[model samples]
Target: MSNYIVRKLKLEKTPQLDHLARAAGELYSRTVVSFWRTVRKKNIWLSGYTMERWHTSSSLHAHSSDAIVQCFYNSLKSWRIRRKTDPHSKPPRRRRWYFKVIWKSAAIKLKGGKLRLSNGQSNSPLIVDWYWEKPSIIELGWNKASQCYELRACYKEEIAQPINDGNVAAVDLGEIHPMVIADGVNTDIFNGRYLRSVRRYQNKLKVRLSKLIDRKKFRSKRRKRSIKSKQKQLAKLNNQIKDIEHKLTSRAVSMLKLRGIQTLVIGDVRDIRNGLDYGKKNNQKLHQWSFGSIRIHLEYKCKKAGIKTVLITEEYTSQECLNCRKRNKPKNRNYRCSCSFEFHRDGVGSNNIRAKYLGIVPVVGLMARPSGLRFHSHIQCNLTDNILLGNPRDSIAGE
Candidate 1:
């Protein structure tokens, strides 16, 4: 749960560090793309992409005199090489000789073994510092331009406080009420502004993109502009959603800490996208749910905040009633349980979700609260393993 970030600044009177960072990032991406294309067609192999290919027995680039070769051998034996993959693909990053020699050389040349940045000039040993109680290690990362530089000190904090006795927070992640939180009494709803805004932009983009075809611009120009604009629009929407979710989750988890909520009961929806038949309709709703994205963000954020998250089986959370044990058979957004359990369908589900955390369903392999709460009876739902809905264990259908 502990990771650090390395930040750098550009020398005064020079272009911003952001420019260099962006360039480095782009180069890195280009290199990976080239490597993938080469590897895919079997035009090159592993040696060409890593330190191995940099110094052959006779290759002078490595300065492989007996001493340098021996040094490399010993270094290889002693150093632990960790791997990183391409951000956008299944391909493993090919570590080249330039990275090995250049980084090592830079580190060696740096003052106190830490890299530095100067006026339009690269300095050895990029600088860094440590915060909290995490260990201090010199880690290297690839910048946008594919340059390998040491990322200096990382600031990471461990905020792990033990949960209070028998207290828990039930989190209902959704589209409308971006976050419907039940703290056993008052329900706080974080409005779905992000969702609404994103949907709006998405709709606008579709209309705009369609209209682009009618523009008087040349065919290639129009196509290129259209594609670029579409990508920009999508990225903007995604960032907006992510920012809202990040802020909302962090705020919510922090609230839990204040409330003495020991454990966070998170409802893990397998996939809001899969159950539906794929097409325009499914896509329209899927965009709004962002089920997978939000869940993933929350998982890591909660962990970092030291809040233990318990992912519950979302069986009939959407339909099961809290009062009167009634099954409302939801006709719309509101849940009118058959047994007349009056409340927001989401509220009833949230209650059941929380109950499960309190030991409501144990036999179903649901890792619930260690306390004495138990699962409720008379409900139905599933999507086992997310997609694979197992047989109904409770009286509910598709349990």
Candidate 2:
């Protein structure tokens, strides 16, 4: 529950350090590539991501004479880099070479509390790692050259049962409002106005930058500083948006806990990978509408409170009018159809969201069930390594 980072200074200003780093990067590539190639062949039926089903890789080594050596991490790497070894034979890779590990075994030894320090510095260059006991996974933070720092360590504590008088609130993610929230008992909770403003600023900046480029004035220091300023604004906007979500979501969660709402119900609004783009007019909006990132934040916060999030199928939760039982959701932002049924579009979609605190959805590739509905199609997938949802209070016990 406690979080702090361990930063160890490891700059050689020496060519030996550079050489060790290069060697390690090459070795890391060699090992990861061979593993992934075999993995790809083994899981031919799965998507590249789903290949984690067949084989999930762990770190490998590049041995060195020195017990302490450099380390590396490539966030999104090419498959070719993993296998290619003849440095002179292949074409240049867009992915740049960075830090990598050379003495992993020794590194592990240091991690286990062995004392090998000299000159009051860590004998081995540090590798940033994260361990969360609740969800139970160890993550390695890749070194970020931009800040000259790895995302080393972050302290995010899970609050167990933070409240007991609140009620279950279902927040629907949307295009305009960004977040449309409603308690299980029916109350409005929304946050998205600033998000819209941020979007506009981003668009304006993009247009301005584009104009400068067209005029061939892109090299001006003024333009560069302006762009940087815009980036800072974008970041500030992101923090504002997330802060709103956290406040609302956490309040809802706390309220639910207070009301004896043992389980918190939420929609699994994830990227279905069906070509969803927020229409990138420029660099800003493209980065702002980080769908994947939003979901991740929600999941992590929910996990801290031992809450359950139901990932209802994404096919038609919005359009299928929760009231009339009619599938009339529009692709655009409009909520009303030819029929006179007018409501806050997202609110209506959310009304149908059933508090599914049971097992998995039995039906695959079909419309997701709403909250408080009996679902025989419910089978449970483990959201976290420690928690499981097997029982149901609604009509379907098999759910």
Candidate 3:
């Protein structure tokens, strides 16, 4: 199996490059909109090749135009799938003036210490400084905050051999604790407090910036400067959030591999925000939750590490007491049952999820004291000193 990741590089701003990228965005919008109009009006589906032919006069490379068509078709295909379950699901109809420009393998070249991106036959090629091997595809994307264009290179990497030891683990995903895993014998909790704090700071900064910008005249020099500064800060915070996500997922996968775990089950909370109305503050926090991003990172990293990931509905995984088979929503981090059996709430959820997936009854005697880990920016992961539930205090150190 093969796995791929994207590396983003900042591109120096130039008038020619800016014009080219904006033109590519226009071409993308025109291609999608034109094809969609044909589909709606003529009730016909235009093939990618046919759409590519329609863009013969485009300044973008032939392969770049093909990428646009491919993107449009993918959106249409996704909409088709969603419409089966969601009757009100709409097709891709929005049009944008500036879209990210993608160049396929055929339009990319690397020579010596330079990378060349083909625009078209008559236009000058975009040659940039390069030191790494050529990537499979390249994308020129606009950064509105910095008012610049950047490049993203996608490269394929070989995947590790599949782990077939048959050991399985279940994960409970939440906003406070991003991931909590249990494998009947071992339990691990990954802390997400830092991620939440960073997001909170971002929201506060955004509000302050918005207020300051609103106080100034619209489109004035001060307002524009404030807006740009705000965007730059938000972008920096966004990057920090992404850094945490990558490290968290990577560390989790690495630990799981070390545990000789093969299959990973993740609790699905996809619709947690559909009609959520838990007051202003709570609503904001939930809306900002990035479970989808965490899941995506986990999925790809697991694939690369030859670990299977599965999602199962977790309707009562969190509240149901494993000991008494009764529902009791924990008020805090610890869950206590009427039968006197207690454990970390997230651990209990993970255990129940595992039980549901494996079609086995949840047993307290089979579970171990859950170990806790807190993620830090300076370190990969740090073991937290937490009191073990129903086990010796040295249980974490033994692991």
Tell me, by TM-score, which candidate is best. Answer: 3
Model 3 C-alpha lDDT versus the unseen true structure: 0.81
lDDT of 1 by residue, 142-253 (tens): 4322223434333454455555535777877776666666766655566675456667777787778768755636668767777666666666666566656655655566
True lDDT of residue 331, candidate 3: 88
Ranking of all predicted structures according to TM-score, beginning with the best and ending with the worst:
3, 1, 2
Candidate 3: clashing pairs of residues: none
Ranking by lDDT: 3, 1, 2
Weakest 10 consecutive residues of candidate 1 by summed lDDT = 371-380
Q: After superposition, how far is residue 81 of candidate 2 from its true place, in Å?
A: 9.6
Clashes of each: 29, 32, 0
Local distance difference test scores for all models: 0.50, 0.42, 0.81
* Candidate 2 displacement at residue 376 in angstroms: 42
Candidate 2 local lDDT, 1-399, one digit each (tens): 432222232232344344444544544454345445655788532233333233321223212312111111232233347447645553222332544333322333233322221111323443332222111111222333222222221223434553442445455665455545444445353445555665676667667766654565557887776666556655665555554544444444444444444444556555443455545454344455544555554555455545555456445667765435567846554567555655556665554454232322212123232222111222122233232221112213322
lDDT tens readout by residue for model 3, 265-373: 9899998898868998898888888889999988887776678888999999999888878999798989998889889989999999998899888777877899998
As for model 3, its CA RMSD to the true structure in angstroms is 7.8
